[model samples]
Target: MRGIGYSLLAAVGAWAFWPTLRDLAEKWQHDPQYSHGLLVPFFVAYLIHRKREDLKQISAVPSWPLSLLFLSTALGCRATSAIFDFLPLDGLALILVLAGAVSLIQGKEMLKTVAPALGFLLFALPLPYSMERWLSQDLQHLATLASTYLLQAIGQPAINEGNVILIDEIKLGIVEACSGLRMLMTFAAFATGITLLIDRSWATKTVLILSAIPIALIVNVLRISATGLAYVLLREAPERQNMLGFIHDFNGWMMMPVALVLFGIELKVLQWLLVEPEKLERVISFPIRREMPEVPARKAA
Candidate 1:
């Protein structure tokens, strides 16, 4: 009976969300910014798998009221997405539908247990076009500013002209493509996944997640600075354009590793600074005996 019910739910969900899923898959393939979306589903599945034991402990007592609410909201989102041609809404609707299904079939405890996995699905969805464009432009400007400062700090004659940096008479444009938004989004998602999987205090998790933004930005700035330095130092090298292009692409590929290294350092720092409550309690509860000097016995004699 449970198998039949699950089969029916899966069929209905697949049929209803086919369009949304198709669009998401295409974006993951074609959109560089959201290419990380390709890995998110697998990560979500892994998260659910990790929670299977905890899930087994919870008895299924379907919550009709909450399930109805979730399903109703999902239906409304789907309708709105269809009416307005909004893809994000479709993604939200899909998540809501999943939540509703879990609530209906496995109960609210199961829903709560799997909520993080469901929420993680949002990382796979693309931002709205307007928001993405605005953010890209802002990040481009910031990157230009930071990279120019870095070049100047290292004794290069650098000037920031809006989104372009002029150093040693070479123009490096911080185009939207170079804005580092992709790194930021990808790192943010990576951090969130790590935070979910790790058993850490909420403070540590929060710090880890928040640190993604600055780490991504810093790595991107370093990349831009290195490119500028390479251009200035090798201005007269033969096939200079080809070399610079290769450097640019290589730096882009290396950004994630650099960010990961920075994140690792952050985790170490957090570990050093933030003591767990249980450990703190043990330390406090441990007895510290102070032995009196043996001179007291001589004095008594």
Candidate 2:
């Protein structure tokens, strides 16, 4: 009965937020980097199978007691949003509560473990115009500094604007849309989801999530460098008209795969280092010899 009440409430909440979610997705499709940033989520599903053994241990009829925590949290967030006037924080909280409650009542450990994917799904939805611009501007500043160092490493003369990377002969400006922060958000979401799904240890999950920030930074740097290289090479040739576009799309596709592979290696290393099978209990208590009744001497046998 408790679960049924939560479900009906969630259904109402979801219906209320459906239009907002649709609009966000519709806008996200317009940005290629964000569109490609979605690949990590698609890859996350591939890793879920790795935990099937442990998942089998989880019960089918979840403990409904767990739902109370999420429902309260979700309601609190929504109430806060209604009073304070914010977009989507309430929606996100509501989703978390609903999903978590359902998982408690129905899903085994495998499904319940993936609360982070809900975050990733939220990232796919579009941000408001003001928030998007603010983030884009900040990320552009970060990308500019990163790319400048990269250009210097390769003996290229470069200059930086607020978000532009100027090569000797051409400019690589961060358009309002190509801000790499979205990729960072996307991967943070992905890392959270995947680690929770396959990783049994809390420590491994922690490392996996912490690693995403640096990984995002590295990938963003590499992307910026690749663009600069393409521009420099193209300027030298002055003939391959469409080559830069190819570089743009190809780099976007490749960076994500490499990051995923590197994360897998990290997971393996963590597993090897941290996990130890439980050994027979060495410190288990035993009765004091004097306190125990002695067996009748073997004479009876």
Top lDDT model: 1
Point out the worst 10-residue segment of candidate 2 by lDDT.
Answer: 276-285
**Highest TM-score: which candidate?**
1
The residue pairs found clashing in candidate 1 are: none
lDDT for model 1, on a 0 to 1 scale?
Answer: 0.93
Q: How close is each model in CA RMSD to the real structure?
A: 2.1, 8.3
> Which residue pairs show collisions in model 2?
none
Error at 222, model 1, angstroms: 0.6
Model 1: lowest-lDDT 10 consecutive positions: 292-301
Model 1 residue 64 CA deviation (Å) reads 0.5
Q: What lDDT tens digits, residue by residue, belong to model 2 across residues 89-174?
A: 65566566756565676664645555545455565544555887787788777777987888888898888877778776687887
Instruction: Give the count of colliding residue pairs in each prediction.
Output: 0, 0
